[model samples]
Target chain A: MNLKVENVSYRLGKKVLLDNVSLSLQERERVAIIGPNGSGKSTLLRLICGLNKPTQGEVLLAGRCVHRYPRRRLAQSLAFVQQKANTEDIVRAEEAVSLGRTPWIKPFEAWSEYHQGFVEKALLQVDMQDKRHQYWHTLSGGEQQRLHIARALAQNTPFIVMDEPTNHLDIKQQLGVLSLIHHIERTMLVAVHDLNHAMRFDRVIVLKDGGVVAQGAPETLITEALIKEVFEVESRVIKSMGFASNVQLIA
Target chain B: MLVKGLQGVMKSHPLLFVLVSTLTLSVFIVLGVAIGETQIDFQTVVYAVANGALGTQYPINAIDQGVVWNYRLTRTLVAACCGSALAITGLVLQSLLRNALADPYLLGISAGASTGAVLVTIAGIGAGALSMSFGALIGAILAFMFVVALAALASGRRMGNISTQVILAGIAGSQLFNALTAFVIAKSANAEQARGIMFWLLGNLSGARWQEVAMAVPVLLFGLMIVLWHSRALDAFLFGSDAAASIGIAVKRVQVVLIFSTAMMTAVMVSMVGAIGFVGLVIPHAARFLFGSSHLVLVPACAVIGAVFLIVCDIGSRTVIPGQVLPIGVVTALIGAPCFALVLIRGQRK
Candidate 1:
């Protein structure tokens, strides 16, 4: 199902965090929401996933308001990987990943092999199968991020939303994660700070001051003028052969 | 050797794991009934149980039967229920609040219950109309509400560090209620009344009749059911409430229902058995250590371990001084304090 965020605005006290922001994601499409700090990128994602109710307008999934759906049902359709979201450091990685199956499991039901298969597959996808028994605190920040992604994968939703998923990852791990994202057929809405990473997405939506400044195919939308206007930085969009355009920042 | 064997069972057969745990709990309960001022053999203890449960004559001595069936059995059963209830409450609180130090009493329930009990015993608030348990329950609920309100107030302005804010509010509320309890006793109680209240406050199971069992069992079962039903949601909270919500959990509703239900269960336990500390704080950690952090395993494991641990503590309380019985709370604290310190030290090392 396609995900829709329609004219959504979120306010905390007198400060408007998200201002009438609207966006949509087609099924199996990968989109990146890129913005400068304090541009309401995270807030927009939260609203879309029904983590926060929009003060104005509504988020619709498959023609129904997102918040109107039952939490478990909504969860089965959309999984979320949050930025800096952590639990008790003592939880084992495998146990943490298996929790993604919460929406599907019923009371008194045993954990079936089917659920275990998903968990194992997710772990393998993130190359975290070896560290599945490790305590969360024992893992590095990058490892933790991968485990978080594995959890969302194990959820096996049609749509997966993420906030700064590649934040703590190294260059190689970042590319690896992006590659994994590319291979996954699920619809993805990722909030990314790295313009280069945003360029790699199928489409990019640039947010500036809580509203979308530009959104389209990255080739057309992510240009020097858009970057200078939205990010207030001088950058050259270097087109490459059979690859996503790389953003080279002017020093 | 036994621990390893049990682990093997737990890994391979879940039904066997439950049966073994139940058997372990029964053995501890039987031991609790057998060892006391007057030593009763295991056979007599079993006979007393059979008579009580199966309505068999059993040909047991009258005094032995009376002591075993009426007094020791009820006390041990009540202790088991109280232990499991507190442990489950602690586990829930730790998960939902995302604080390692979170316990059943952290939200001021125990302190409030003590104040309520003191009010009834000293100030004559109900004037013989209300029982101490009822008063304690009232005080507990009121204290929990106060903590909730304080937490809400603190969280209203900023959406940052809610778990820490709630923990701070809990500390503040506990201090306030504890002070109130102290103030009431100092202001109103005479020498004998003060001593009686003190004894009760330190935890006494002398009053654990069948009625207490009837009260505690259902509450424990209900609370366990509520927790078990939402075990998946609890597991989802591994990464905090926001993460739980993103995964389709009704975070607010789940949090409210869980905290409220666990708090109520904790209050009931405290009202029945005073503030038996440590079991709530320690058992869940031990369970998590033995079994991983899955609530599916941890909940039942904590319940069983907590129940057995309390029964052992009760036995220690009964037999430690030879002729005199120590307060179960004092015994638990004595044992619990060291174990708690060990938990802290181990946590630091890890």
Candidate 2:
């Protein structure tokens, strides 16, 4: 499904958090939203997931306004994995992953075989199938992050939106999860603080002061001039062997 | 082999766990009805039960019939209902607010009910036999509405509410109603009347009758069924409201229905058995170990475990005094605190 954000804005009290942000994303497209801290990446993701309303303008999924569909219908087509998604209770790993089937399962019914298969496949994808019975609080932070992604995958939606998807992850876990995310074959809109990770996306949308500063294929848009202007950081773009650009931030 | 088999069965079928717990409760219930001031024998009690089942076809003597059928039967059954109602209500509130300390009385409904009871007992608004119950129900609903309205106000621009803010508002609401109750007790009543009010506030179940039991049982069962129907939604809610909504659960609508149902059940239980404490606060946590916080399993576990807990406590209240009946609330707190300490110790050891 195609997602179109049409000049949407959101205000919190006296402060405007999203200012006329608009974008059109194609099916199976991998787009990255990157910016400094508090640059409205999380807010925009919230609006896209229908968890928050736009102060003005609109969001359309498959050319229909997103607000028109009920929340369940919207969830069937899309899933959102939030940054710092946490539960303080002692939930088993498999139980947490199975929660993604909630939109499909009825209140009185148990999880069907197909739903169970989804949970199994999701855990397999994240390589956490062996630890499915472990309690969530007992898992390492990186393992928990991987489990959270598996939960999002278990939703079985065509599109997945993530905010700071690799937070609390070690480098190996980060690379592994990102590799898994790349091959999951879903339309993805991921917000990240890592400029290097953003550079690997098909498109990078750089945000500053609650508006899009630049957006395009990373090779074309992520210039040293643009980095200094948007990030307020002095940096050199290193040409790496397999990466589009390796950003080395400098003081 | 036997222990493993038992464990497997318990794990696979949650209903079997509920069945076993209910069997335990049934034993306590029998004891509750049989052992009174006069200490009726078990066979005699069984005969009375069978006679009642047969509509008194083989009638027992009138005095024994009155003791078993009228007094012990209603009060014991009512105590069980109170246990089931308050425990489930606490479980709902605890899950809804994501707070271990949240109980059925957190919404000020008990304090509201107390204020209403005070008005009837002292001011003579409706001085009939059942007016106290009626006034208490009205007060419970009113307090529920005020807490919800206040939560809505404090929740601010966020679509998903903050449970802590709602809880804080509830405490404020509770204090308001409690002060009103205290003022009425101080000014409008004599010393003897004040003493009775204190006993009522501390939850005495001596006035429980068949009429109150008839009203409470159906409401508790129906309310529990509705909660069971939405068990999956509540399980999703165990994480957080945002996570629940992300799974396409109607977070606000479900919260509203759950709050009202719990309040209604609490009102009915309180009208029959004053403001019984600790059963709601502690039983759900004890049941959580058996069922592991999934509402489908947890609800039934709470129902059975809470029933057994209350019936045992009621028996203690009766037997501790030779002829005098003890307040159910005092017994619940006095027994509950040490048990709660043990639960804490066990939890930490785990």
Candidate 3:
């Protein structure tokens, strides 16, 4: 499914949160959205996921307005992993992951092995299969974040939208999650804070002051100039380990 | 022992678990009917019910049969309905609002009902035309509307975290209504009338009758069905409303419908039985501790456990003080407060 945000603007009272922000994604594409704080990255993700409506424009999926379809139908094709989602409910790791099957299951439908298969696969993907029976509160912050990603993965949607899925992870787990996203046969739109990590995605969209400043292939768009302009930091882009481009912030 | 035994049954066979729960409710209802002020035997209570329900010609005292069939049975059934409805409301509110302390009375329904009943009884607001229950129902609806409006006003532009605003508004509305009730009673009521109104406010089932049973059961059933139908959506709310919406739930629609339904069910139960406390606040947590947090299991578990808990409490109210029957609310609080503390302590340890 192709996801398109056409001239979306969200305003809260007199303050403009997102102004005329637009982007489009092709099927099986991996796009990273990077922005300074208060640049509306989370707002854009919420709009695209249909958790909130765009004030002036609309988000469309496969040529239909995203809000036109029933929430269940929309969710069957697009999964969302929220940033820093937490719950007070006492749920096991596997039980929490099983909720990803919600869009697929009817109200009284029996949870068949087919559904359970996705939960197991998701747990394995996040490397939390060993802790499937553990309580959610017992998990560390990074592990909790992984479970959130695993929940999105278990939804089995073609388009997955996540906000800072790697926020709390250490370097090893961060790379593991990124690599997993890279290899998956799904279209992914992820908001990331790490400019270095953002450089690896197939495409990058940079936002500053509620609008898209630049977007395109990582190599072409993420030059030293764009980083300094958008992020307000002196930085250099260099070839790291032969095949990868790395961004190093200059002091 | 029962909680552990139930855990084992829940893990092994879902059908057997349901059967066991239903049996427990039935047993409690029978015990509630039998062991009242007049000690009707268990067989006699069952026979009286059969006679009343099926026209069975059982040779029993007319007074005993009448007491069992008309009074105790109706009281116990109404108590069960109130417990189930209140617990379901609590579970739904806690999950939807993401507040652990949410309960049926948190929306100010109980306080409103108390005020309304007081007005009708002492102030003679209805001039003997409106019954206390009807007045209470009206008050509950009015108080709920006030809370909703206050919550909306407080939240204003940012509707993101309205649940907290709602909790606050409910607190304010409850305090306001409770003050109104106190003021009215203090101003107008004589000692005898004040005493009666106070007893009713503390929760009384002395007035529960067949008519009440007829009213309460269907409301409970309807409320249960609505809640069970939305159990999946309720589970989605574990992570909050935004997460629930992202997972295909129509968060606003579900919230409005469930909240309205639970409120209506609670209003009816409160008017019928004077706002029995603790079942709503404690039973869901207890159920979650025994069963898992999945609403699919939690809903049924709460219904059964809540019914049994209230039935047992009703029995305690009748028999605890020898000749004089204590108010049902007092018994529940006397028992529930300690049990709730224990639940909190156990939860913290876990």
Each prediction's whole-model lDDT (CA): 0.87, 0.84, 0.89
Residue B236, candidate 2: alpha-carbon lDDT: 84
Which rank order by TM-score, best down to worst? 3, 2, 1
Error of 3 at B65 (Å): 1.8
Candidate order by lDDT, decreasing, is: 3, 1, 2
Indicate the residue-level lDDT of A232 in model 3.
90
Candidate 1 CA-lDDT value: 0.87
Models sorted by DockQ, best on top: 3, 1, 2
iRMS values for every prediction: 1.2, 1.3, 0.8
lDDT of 2 at B177: 93
- A93, model 2: CA deviation in Å? 1.0
Which scores greater on TM-score, model 1 or model 2? 2
TM-score of each: 0.94, 0.96, 0.96
**Candidate 1 lDDT by residue in tens digits, B3-47:** 335444565688887888889997898788888989788898889
Tens digit of per-residue lDDT, candidate 3, span A18-76: 99988999988999999999999999998899887889999999999998989888889
Instruction: Locate the minimum summed-lDDT window of 10 residues in model 1 chain B.
Output: B1-10
lDDT of 3 by residue, B102-147 (tens): 9999999999999999889899998999999999999999999899
Highest DockQ model number: 3
